[model samples]
Target: MADLFDNINDWLMQEALDENPLTSIVETFGRRLVEGGVPVARISIGRSILHPTIGLLDVQWEQDTGQVNTQAVPRQIVRNSLEIFDTPFGELSKGKTDRLFADLRDPDEVARFPMFEQLAARGMTYYAAFSRSFGRTHHLYERISNEFRGASLSFTTKRFSGFSQADLDGLERVLPAFCICLRMDIERFVAGEILETYLGKISGKQVLDGQVERGDGQEIDCAILYSDLRGSVTLSQTLDSTAYLDTVNAYFDCVATAIDEHGGEVLKFIGDGVLAIFPFDEANRPRANMCAAALSSAQEAFARAEHANRGRSGDGLPALHFGVGLHVGTVIYGNVGTARRLDFTATGPAVGLASRCEGMTRELDTPLVATGAFAEHCPRAGADLGQHRLRGFADPIALVSYPLT
Candidate 1:
């Protein structure tokens, strides 16, 4: 336990201080408590969580009142912790004691967690948890919980051996260091929010550490937008390698610029094409972000293409254009590939749909086209182009997109 606390303090000073400090501080503490033998812990930024889009979540973790469940008196109730969208899900797991892989052999589980009967098959029993808050955005909540079977020091054996009390005291001593870094996180979150709102977005890249908080460098549901320079292939064939790269880079500049303008993160570029993400945020859904960004990027790309073609004195050639596609649904969004090397790209059904949309941009004589889902939520969804029966999908989807404005 002493070693674990020392590690937490060191991480608090190091990893906790980053572009977004509050989130790092909370995660640091939550994970440390898990390793501390508390088995289970949680940080409640407020008594519960209250937000508009949380309709799908209804669980004990959501802070409804400052009363702190005086109605229940949870095993280890700490107040004013971090606020997260997934809090209810984790709390349900712990409160219901459904996650214990060790407590299955114990009889207490039958009375305490009838729902966790499957847990005993896996060998688990009861769990312990701790929670607290930090940072100016005291809304930040973090929790740590773990389980037990009939293993280790039982409740009856604790009186005969004094090690349990000693261990808890050691954990208490280590908690203060985490508190220090949490203070810094609070300051940074407030300062950064104020600065950005006042000065405007300082960096061209999108800011998304908040949305990806739970992604431990792995894949998730995200809208991926791919934009390719249609005429670049022909242009590159005529130019030297250096000139080709310069031309491609110029097109990349335009695509990336539009993506950032509409709150999308550029993940990578494939030669003349660029891949980016319209990640879900506190305000908007994933479907909305994807269509808005695709429409914006297409307009931006076409404008630049026309301007460049005119500047080049294209006496007989058609103005350059881009084929763009957007599809919404689950796609892997983490670092996946070789163990030594990986790329944070989404794959699966949605990506294929996006590819089909891009193909339609060329066939339909339009710069922007998206799958059916985009029309459902996009703020600027204009008209339906018609239904498309993609090669693999079981049902034909209604393709929709906006005319470049």
Candidate 2:
């Protein structure tokens, strides 16, 4: 066992030295976990050990795509744990997921994990959920096998048994090395891959992968703003579809570029409309003084676009015009919907009100309008645009105009 572990360690060292140490750490140690005294069914890998029902490594056995061994694993059990730590207990993972976790030293919780028994129905015998906390977040690790298949007594015979105390002990013994390997992998992945992915997404490289907030399922005070091209409809009608698409895409580029530069996350793109958030994070609240930054960013974006459309003399290119609305309120900011389909959108009247406020920009002949909540913190911005009665709102709201200096 020492020799085998040494080989795996060396493989990890080589990966750490040569390629991405992060991927190698997960790959090397993840394999050892699955092969440990069980007829493993499926395996999954997560970044850290403080896993709240997430997979660190995953493999499934299939019968038809045709095979003798079959494994059934819950899809949500541990796949997208990248953002689970903040997903409040009982919201995503149950309050007590396992016996070996923060605040769960009780022996009864050892059986609280439903996967152990569920996996047994299909001949699975035993399973385990392991975790470790790294940095400010937690990571999870899981391994399970069928009674008949898990034992795998012979090369030809796949059998399973419930995990024995000795087996669990064995797992406990080698976990330190595994943790070290996984830590290295996580660092590499975050630095080499995740950062680049974030940069690309923020810059709208793979436009489909937009921003989603990974936060607790609770209402948080935030400033939600939306923008849409004013003359998009006429442009699409006058120009061919391909040309219109090109023009709209270029418009998207302008909006995203500004959002990224200003530290805002582009939530989603709706046709020619862009939804985004500024200074979003836990513990951060909407402040009128800081609101200028977002508005300034938006103004700079329009200036750039208008500057670009100057030389397109006869292209029938739509005038680079957009209306922006801002509203500050307690909006639900986290991954919402379901495991299969989730949207990172701000819920509550604040977002819709912001949209409605933006719509007013077209009607009011102004480029920007902010809700009273948005202006609540601005330093002497009341003198600029002043107050107005917002439609659908009972009380009158005070706000400042766009293009903050």
TM-scores of the candidates in the order shown: 0.45, 0.49
Model 1 / residue 53 / CA error / Å: 40
- Model 2: per-residue lDDT, tens digit, 214-304? 4434565666778898888788888899988888887787777887677676777888998876644544433653465567667767777
State the displacement of the C-alpha of residue 123, model 2, in Å, after optimal TM-score superposition.
60
lDDT of 1 by residue, 307-387 (tens): 777854555433455777776666665545665654445567887777777777877887778777866666775678888
Instruction: Report the number of backbone clashes for model 1.
Output: 49
User: Residue 189 in model 2: shift from native, Å?
Assistant: 4.9
- Best candidate, TM-score: 2
- Per-model root-mean-square deviation over C-alphas: 19.9, 18.4
Q: Candidate 2 has what TM-score?
A: 0.49
